[model samples]
Target chain A: MESNRRKFLKVAGISALGIAGAKPVLNAFASEQEEEAQHADVEIRKNEKALTARQWAMVIDTRKLQSEEDLKPIIEACHKTHNVPDVMDTENAEYDEDNQRHVIKWIWEEEYKHAFPTKSTEFLDDRLKNLPFLVLCNHCENPPCVRVCPTKATFKREDGIVLMDFHRCIGCRFCMAACPYGSRSFNFRDPREFIKDEDRNPEFPTRMKGVVEKCNFCAERLAVGKQPACVEASNGAIAFGDLYDPESEVRQLLKSNYTIRRKQGLGTGPAIYYIV
Target chain B: MLELTVKGSKKYFGWMALVLGVIGIGFCVYVWQLISGLQITGMSRDVSWGFYIAQLTFLVGVAASAVMLVIPHYLHNYKAFGRITILGEFLAIASVTMCLLFVIVDLGQPMRLFNVILHPTPGSVLFWDMVVLNGYLFLNLIIGWNVLEAERNQVPPPGWVKPLIYLSVPWAVSIHTVTAFLYCGLPGRGYWLTAILAPRFLSSAFAAGPSLLVLLCLLIRKISKFDPGKEQIQSLAKIITYAIILNVFFFFCELFVVFYSQIPEHMDHFKYLFTGLHGHGVLVPWMWASLGLMIFSIIMLVIPSVRKNETTLAIACIAVFAGTWIDKGMGMISGGFVPNPLHHVNEYVPTVPELVITIGVYGIGVLILTALFKMAISIKEEVAA
Candidate 1:
C-alpha cells in the first residue's frame, strides 16, 4: 500500500510537471494510469473468491425464551461486562421515558417492524403484535453500516462479524443511522462514567462520546477460539457455529427448525438466524 | 457619492457582527467533544443527527433562495430585481459556504472527508448530496462572478454565460431538492418517506429564502442608500405569500395522510413531531411557533396595504423567515428521529463546541457575504457613473 501510494505521488508529480511543460505528454500519461488502475481492480476481483475463513454465525431459538424477566439478567450481564452505557436518561427521554430508552449489548428485540410498507403489520392485541427476536449486528452480506461510514471505522472481518475500530471513529454516528435493525448504539457520554474502575471487558473496549459502538460478535474472543459472551450466557438456547461448515451445530439447528431473521425483507441477509 | 464606497455601511454593523463573532467564540468550550467524541452534544444513539443537520437544512433553503432574484431578473427580464440580484447571490454564496461547513462539523472525523471522494459510494444519498452541493457551489461561483463581472465591465454577459444562467434556475431548485432527498430517501424515517417532502422543502425555502433577501434589501435601502425598488420588493412578497401557503398546504396534506393511514409506524413520527409522542414535548412549542409565524406572515403579506407598507412587510418577512427556519431546520430533522425506530428517544442539543463551530461557520459566511456585497455596491457605484 505504501509503495503504491509513493508510486502514485511520484506519478502525479511527474505528470503535473509534464503538463506544465507539454500537454500531449500529460494526457498520454493520465490515460495510461487510468487503464492500469482498472486492471488492478480486475486482478483483485479474480483473487477474491479464493480467500476463506471460518464464517461465524449465530442461531437464536425464540420459542425457548419465555419473558423479558427471564432474559434480562443474561442481557444485563453481557452489557454491563461489555460497558455498554445505558442511553435512557438523555434529552430524547421526552419521546419515551427513561428505562424504555433502548440500549443494546447483545440482547433481544421484543418487537421489530419491517422497513417495507407492505411488510409492516400489527396484531389485534398489543402483546401479540410482533414476535420477539434476538437482535445484534447482522454481519450482513452487504452491510449498510460499513458502506456509509466515512472513516471506514466499521468494517466486516473475514470471519463474517462486522468489526468497529472505536479509537479511529470520528463519532459522527452515521453507522447508527444507517443500520436498519437499530442494533448500533452511540456513546452519547463517555462509557467510562458507567464502567466500574477495576472491572472492564478487555475483549470489548469501552467507547468514548460521539463515536458509535456496537456488537462486534466478540471478534477478540473469536480470535482465541472462544464463543461470544452472549452465546455462552444464553443457557445454550443460542447456538454459535461456522456458517461455512455444513456439519456445524448452527447449521444442524437451521436444518431442523424453521429459521428466520429479524427483518428478512430488508435484504441484509443477516448471518444470525432465529428458530421460530 | 465617493464617500459611500469609502465609508462602510453602518459603522455599528462591524461591531454587531463582531459581537456575534464573540458569542460564537464562546461555543469553543465544547471543543472537548471533537476530542472526546460526539458525547458533548445532547445526542444519543437513537437521535443520531441533531441541531447541526437541522441548521444545515434551513441554511440550504436560504442558500437556494438566491434563485428567486436570479430567475425573475434573467429569465423574465424583471428590471425591478436588477439592482438586488447581486445581494441574493451574495447571500446564497454565504449561506452555502456555511452549509458545507456545517456538514464538516457534523462529521465525526472532518479530516476523513477526503475518503468520501477516494472511496465514493454512489448508492448512498450522502454521496449524492456531496456531489450536488459542491456542484451547486461551483455553479453559483461562476454565475455570481460572471454576472458581477458583466455589470462591472458594462457589457452584456457572454452568450455562453446565458446557458449557465438558465441552468442555474433549475440548479438552484436542485440544491434544496437534493437536500430534501437526503432525508426523504431514508427508508426508515417515516416523516421523510413521503414523496411530497422535496416539493415541501422547495416551497418553504422559496418562502423563507426570498423573505430573508427582501429583509436584507430593505436594510440595504435604509443604511446603504441602495433602493431595490418597491415593486420588486412587493413582487417577492407576493411569491412568499403563495409559497408559504403551498408549504402549509403540503404540511396539512401530510398530516391528513398520516391520520388516514392510521399506520402506527407512520403516525408515530407525526405524533412525536406535533403532540409529543410518549411524552416528548420539546418540539411542540417550536412547531406552534413555526405555524403561528407562517400564518401571521401570510396574513401580513396578503394584504396589499400591509405588504406595501415597508415596515409591515419587513416584520412579515422576519416572521416568515424565522418560522420557516424553525419548521424546516429544527422540527423536521429532530421529529424524524425522535422516538427512534426502536421507540427510543435520544434528544439532540448542540454542545458548546458544536455551537462554536456553528457560529464560526456562520461568522465566516457573514464575512464573505459582507465582502461580496461591499464589492457589488462599489461595482454598481462605478457602473452608475
Candidate 2:
C-alpha cells in the first residue's frame, strides 16, 4: 500500500512536470493510468460468473411473503453472510439504555406503518395494516449519503450499490445523518465482540467499532457471480436484477405488478420497491 | 505580550489553576472515550450525534459572534466598540478552539480526521464547515494578534489586516451558514429540512455569542484595571435584544408551519421534543425551561429601562446564553434524531464520561479565554498609562 501511494505521488509529480512541458503528454499519461486501474479491477474479478448490471434493484413482493416467519431466513442469510453483529444477544450489552437503539442490521423487517410512514394510514386493510416490509439501503439514484460523506467512504458504485470502504471510513457518521431511510448503522462498540465464531463468515470481513456500516446490496457476492444471500434465501419473495435491463427480473416484476418506493416525494429514486 | 499573561493577580492565577484542574480530569476521561469508542456517549445508531456535536454547533455561533463587534467597529467606525472588539476577537479564538476540539472528540476515527483534507471533498457540507472554521480561526488569530501587537508597539496595524478584517465580516456568517448546511440539506430529517435553518442558526448565534461577550465584558470590569465601558455594554445589549427577538420569531414561524400543516413527519419531531412522542420525554422539561428562559430574557431586554441597567442586563444575558444553549445546542440535534428516520423514539442523554469530557472541553476554552483576556487587558492598561 505504501509503495503504491509513493508510486502514485511519483506519477502525479511527473504529470505536474509534464503539464509544464506538453499538454498532450499529460493527457496520454492520465489515460494510461486509467487503463491500468481498469486492468487491475479485471485481474481482481477473475470469476467468470460475476453478475453484471447497469443499475441494480430489488423487488419485495408481499404476496409471496405470507407471514413474519417467511422473513426470518431472508434476514438470517444476509446477516450471517455479512457478519452483522447480533447486538441484543451480547452479554452485558445492557450498557445501552435501550439495546434496540444500538442494534445493527444490514437488512431487517420494519412494520408497514413505520416503513412507509408517509404512506401509512390507520384504516388500511387489516392484512396491509400489520404487514412487515423489508427495509435496507435504498441504493438511491441520488444518494444523500454519498453527497454528504466528507471522506467519500460511503459511496455509490457504478452498478448502483451504495458500498462502504471500511478501511477509508473516518466514522464521522455524517452519512448516517444524511441517510433518509434509517438504513445506515454506526458501530457504537466493537462489532466483532458480538458475532459468534460459528456464525461469522470467513469470506466476509467484520467491521470495527466506531465506523458506520449498512447494506451494500451484497456487492461481494455479486462480484463472485452469485445472487445476494437474501435473494437466494427469500424463496422468490424477493427478486433482484438490473433495473435498466427490461428483460431482468426486477423490471419484469415492476412492469407486471403495482409497486411503491419509500419516500418517493423526496426524489431519492430508491432502487428497493415494495409490491403491495 | 506573552509575559503579560504569565504575570497576573492571585485571583487570576487561582482561576487559571481551577481551569487547568478541570482540563486534567477531562483529558483523562477523553482518553477513556478514545479507547472505548462512542459507546460511552448517549448516542446510538438512531441518534448518531449527541452532546459533542451539539457543543460544536453552539460554539461556532459563539465564534461567529465576533463579527457583531467587527461590523460596528470597522464598518461603521463606532468608537465605543473599539475598546471591546479585541475582547470579541480573542473570545472567538477560544470558542473556535473549543469547536475544533468538540469535532475531534465526536469523531469515531479522530486519527483519520485529515482524510477530509486528504480526500478534498468539496461536495460535502462537512468539508466546507471544516474549511470555513479553520479559516475563521486563522483569520482571527492573525487579525487579533497583529492588531494587538501593533498597539503594544505603539504603531499602526499593518495594511494587510484591514482587508482581512473586512473579509472576516462575511467569513463569520459563512462559518455558521456552512454549519447549518450540514443539517438543512439532509434528505429525511424533517426538523432540519427547513430553509430558514441557516437564518435561525445565525440569529441564535448573534444573540448567544453577544450575550456571552456581554458577560465576559462584565467579568473584565469587575476584575481588571481597564473597563470594557458601559456604552459598549449597552450597545451589545441592544444587539442581543434584537437578535434574540429575531431568533424567537423565526422559531415560532417554524412551529406554525410544523403544527398548522400537521405534517406528522415534521410535527412529530416537535411533539417528541416539546411534548414527548411515545412515553419518551427526557428532553421535554429541558426544552420548556429553555423556552421559558428565552421568553423571560426577551421581556427583560425589551424593556429599555431594564436594558440600560447593568444588573438586569447581565441577568438577561445569562438567560440568553443558557436559553440558546439548551434550544440550539441541545434541542436542535436531539430533536432532529429522536424520531429517527423510521419514526422511532430512541432517547439520548449524555453519559457521565461524555458530560465530563464536555466540561473538560469548556474548561480548556475558559483557560484560553482567560489568557487572551489577561493579555488584552494588560495591553489596554499599558496604553492607558
Candidate 3:
C-alpha cells in the first residue's frame, strides 16, 4: 500500500510537468490557427478597399505664373482656407518693409531680383522687369529645418510630405532660424483668437501659443487619398503627381522643362520644382 | 563674505554712482520690458538674434578676461598679479552677471527658461550655453569668494581650492569659445560659419576684454586709492598688443577668403557688413570704424613710446573695447540676417523698449560691479593695513 502511494505521487508530479509544458504549445497552435483565419479575412477585404500607394510631388510652371495676377488666387485661397487672419501688427511683420502685419502668406510673390541675385534682367522690358513667380515651401527630401528641429516636431511622412506636429513644439524658434526659406511661423499669441469657429479646419491642428507651426502639405487629406488643398485650389497652376512615375504630370514636366528651386545652390534638393 | 565700509572720511564714489540716480530711474523704465515681450526689440524672424545676444557675446568675452590675470598669477607664478588678481576675479563676476542679465532681459520668454533644465534637449546648443554660462558664473564666484575670504583671514586657501583656481584657467577660455560656437554652428549664415571663428573670438576677447580690464583698473584708481601699478598696466598692454595683432590677422583672413573666393553667400555678408548691400549701408560705417579703431589701437600698443604713456594706452584700450564691441555686437548679428538667402534685407535697429531694457540690465551690472568693487577695494586696503 505504501509503495503504491509513493508511485502515485511521482506519477502525479510528472503529469503536472507535462501539462505545464504542453499548455504553451497548445496556445501557440491556437494563435497560429487564428492568424491564418485573420490573414484570409484580410486578403478578402483588401480587394474592396483598393489601397493604392501614392507619393506626392508638386510642379509649378512659372510660364503659367507669367504675371503676379496668376499667383494671387492661389495665395489668397491658402490664406483663406487656413484662416490665417490678416496680421494686425503689420508694423512688426518680418517681411513687411512698413512693418505692418498682414496675412501670413504661404505663397510669396517672388521675382528675378528676389529669387536669383546672380541673374540679371537688364535687357528685359518694363513688363518683364520683375516677372513675379509664386514661391512656397519646397518640402525638400533632406530638409535643413527638419534636421535641426530639437523637438522632432517637424518630420517627413512616407508620402513625401514634411509635416509639423505643433503639439510637440516648445517654440524655441530654432526651426525658424534654421529654415532658409522662412517657411515656418511662431504662433506669438493664441492663434485661435484670430481664427473663427467656422474657419477652423479639423484636419490641421490649431496651434497653441509658444509653438512653431508650418505648412504640412495637408497630409490628413493625402491619407484619405485626396490631393493637397493648395494644389487642388490652384486652378491647374500647380501640377500634382508622383515624381517617381515617369509618365506622371510632375515627372514629365520635370523631364521636359528646365526647372529651378528658390535656392538651388543651397543643395537642399527640393522635391518641388518651378519651371521658368 | 562682502562687507560695506563707508567711513565718513573716505570719499566714497559709490555715492556718486548712486548720484547718477536719473540714469538708474531711466534704467527702471527700460526694465518694464518684461511685461512687453521681445516685440519691443529690433529683432524679427529673419534677424532672430540681435542686441541682447550681441551684448551677451561681448560680456562673455569680458568675463573671460579674468583668464589673463589667472594665467599669469597661477600658472606662470607672476606675483605682480597677486595684489590685483582678486580685482580681475571680481570684474569677471560682475561681467558674467551682466552677461546672464542681458540674456534674460533679451529672452522672449524669461519665465520659461528653467524648462531648458527640466526638459533638457541634448541637441540644442542653447541648452549647453545655459550650462556653460551658469557653470562659469558659480566657478568664478566660489573661487573669488574663497580666495578673498582666505586673504581676509591672512592665510593661504586650503590645498583643494588651488585645483579649482587651476581649473578656472581653461574654463574661462571655454566660456568665450562656447559663445563663438553659438554663432559659428549655424549652417546657412555664411558670415560666421568658419573654423577660425572660435580663435578670432578668443583673440578679440584677449584684445578687448583685457583692454576693458585696464580701463576698469584706471576707473578704480580714479574712484579709489588702489594703484595696480605701472608695471602691471604695461604687462596687460603688451598682452593686448599681441592679442590685437592676432585679431586683426583673423579679420584679414576672413576678408581674403570672402573676397578671393567671391562665393556669393559668404561674400554678400561681408559686403553687407563692410560696403553695404541692397540699400542697407547703415552698418558699413560702423564696421569700418571698428576695423580702423582696431588697427589704430594695435599700432599704439605695438609702438613702445605710445605704450609707455598712460593717456595713449588708455585711449588705445578704450578704442579697442569700443571697436570690438561694435564689431561683435552690430556687425556679427546683423551681417548674418541681411541679404538672406531669399535676397531679403531685414534691417535690425533696437527699439525704445529694447534700448530701455538693455540699459536697465546694464545699469544693474554696473550697480553690481560698483558695489562689489567698493567692498573688494576696502578689504584690500584693510589687508594692506
Candidate 4:
C-alpha cells in the first residue's frame, strides 16, 4: 500500500509539471486564434457593408485628365474648399529670382514623367507622355507619416483615411520627410496672410503658421454623406470607395483597368491608383 | 559647486560674457521666430528640416560619445580614464542640453511640445527618440554628478550608482540608434532607408565623440591644473581610428550595394551628393570636402608618430570631428530630402536668423560645458593637492 502511494505521488507531480509547462503554450495558441478571428471579422464586415469598411481608397482615371485644363477644376475645388493658402508672392532671396519658396499645395498637378517616374518609358505614347496627372496624398495603407508624427496630429481613421488634426500639428515636418508622395505642405509663414479674406472658405478652418497640413480625404464631407470635393468635381473621373470591399467601386475600377500606383514597389501600399 | 565657476580668471569671465551676449541675441531672435513663425528661417515645404535638425543630429553623437570614456573606465576597468571620464560626461550634459534646445526651436509650435509626452504613441520613432534622449540626459546628469561628488569626497560611489553607470553604456548606444531610426524607418527616403544606418551612426558617433573628448582634454590641460593624461588621449585616439575606419567602410558598403545594384532610387541621392543630379549639385563641393577631410585624418591617425604627437593628434581630431559633423549632420539630413518623393531637387540654405540661432545654441552648450568643467576641474585639483 505504501509502495502504491509513492508511485501515485510521482505520477501526480509529473502531471502537474506537464500542465504548468503547457499553460503558456496553450494561452499563446488561444490568443493567436483570437487574432485570426478578429481578422476574419474584419473581412466579413468589409464584404457586408462596402462603404462602412475600415479601409478608404481612391482611384484616379488619368485617361480622363487629358490636359492642364482638365486638372484645374478638381485642384481648385480642393484648394478653395479647404481654404489652402496661396503663397505666390512669398519669395526666398537665396534661390533664383523665379524660384518661389513659399508655394504651398495640398493637391496639385504634375506631368506624367514626374508623377509616374518608375513606370515611365521612352516607348510610351506621346499623348500619354504629355498628359498631366492630378496627384495628392496616397493615404497609404501603412502610412510613414503617421508612424513618424511625434504628436498624434496626423492619424489614420478607422476607415483608413489619413486625416490631419491641424490644431495638434507641432509642425516638426518629420511627416513631410517620411511621406514618399510629397503630398504634405508646411506653412512657411502665417497662411492667414496669404489667404484672401474674401476667398477663404468659412466652413473649413485655415491653418496657422508653423503647422503641417495635407489632404485629409475630406473626412468632414464623408462624415456628412457627401463625396470628397475633388471626386465631386471630377464627375466620375475619380472613384472614391472602400478598398477592402471586393465589390466596391474602387475595387471594380482597379479590376477593370490596368492601374498603377506611384512608388508601389516601395511596399507602402498606396491607396491612390492611377488608371493609364 | 556654484562658487567654483566664479573663481576663474579675467579671460574666463570675458569668455562667459561673450557666450552670454550671444545667448542674449539668440533669445531676441527666438522671440522673433516665435512671433513670426518658421518663415524667418530658410526652410521650405520641400526641405523641411535644415541647420537646426542637422546640429541636433551631430550633437546627439557628441552626447553619445561619453560612452567611449564610460566603457573603458567602468566596464573594462581601465583606470587611466578615471580623471577623463568626468570630462566626457560633462561634454555629454552640454551637448544633450543643446540637442533638446534645437528640437524646441525647430518645432512649429514649441508650446505643444508636451503633446508628445501627454499623448504617447509607442509606434512613432520621434516618440522613442524623445524618450531615449531625455532618458540619456538624466542618466548622464545623475551618473556624472554622483561620480564627481564621490570623487570630491574621496569615497567610492554609492552602490546604486554603479548599475546606473553600466546602464548608461547601452543607453548611450540606444540614444544614437533611436536617432538614426528617426531617418532610417522612413519608407520613401531612399538615402535614409537602410538597415545599416543605426550601425553607421554608432560607428560615426564612436569616432566623433572620442575625437571631441580628446580635444577637450587638451583644452583642459592648457586652461587648468587638471591633466587628462597622455595615455588616456592615446587610447582615445586609437578608439577614434578604429571607429572612423569602420564608419568609412560601412559607407563604402552602402555605396557598393547602391551602385552595384543599379537601382535608381538607391543611386539617386548618391548621384546628387557626389555628382549633382539633374544639374543641381549644390552639395557636391561640401560632400567632397567632407570626404577629403575624413581620408586625410584617417591617414594621419593610422600612423603611430602622427597619432602620438599632441599637435598632430589635435589636427587629426579636428579633421575627424569636422568630417563626421558634415557627413552626419548636413549630408545625411539634407541628402535624404533631395530627389524628394517626386524626384525633384530643391536645395536648402540656412538664412541669417537660422545661423544666428544655431550659434546661440552652440554658445549655450559651450557655457554649460564651461561651468560643469569648472566645478569638475576645481574638485580634481583640490583632490590632487
* Clashing pairs for predicted structure model 3, backbone only: A87-A102, A89-A101, A90-A99, A90-A100, A90-A101, A91-A99, A91-A100, B30-B356
Residue B42 CA error for candidate 3 (Å)? 2.3
Query: How do all the candidates rank in terms of TM-score, highest first?
Result: 2, 4, 3, 1
Report every candidate's CA lDDT. Answer: 0.74, 0.91, 0.74, 0.88
What's the lDDT for candidate 2?
Answer: 0.91
Give candidate 4 regions above 4 Å deviation. A1-53, A89-99
TM-score of chain A of 2: 0.83
lDDT of 2 by residue, B132-232 (tens): 99999999999999899888878989999999999999999999999999999998999999999999999999999999999988888888889999999
Docking class of 4: medium
Predicted candidate 4 versus true structure: per-residue lDDT over A1-276, tens digit per residue? 964885698689879999998886688679879999899867432332233556888999987888888889999999999998767645555543322566778899987778887877888899877888988999889888988888789998898888898888888888999898889988877889877888989999998988998898887777667789999999799999998889899999988899989999878788999998
Candidate 2, residue B338: Cα displacement in angstroms equals 1.9
TM-score of chain B of 3: 0.95
Most accurate candidate by TM-score: 2
Largest lDDT belongs to which candidate?
A: 2
Displacement of the residue A155 alpha carbon in candidate 2, Å: 1.0
lDDT of 2 by residue, A1-276 (tens): 965885698699879887786875567679879999889877553568788887899999988886779999999999999999988884675654456767888898888878988988878898888777789988999999999999888888889888999888888999999888999998878888888998899999999887988998999899888899999999898899999999999999999999999998998999999899
How much is A184 displaced in model 2, in angstroms? 0.7
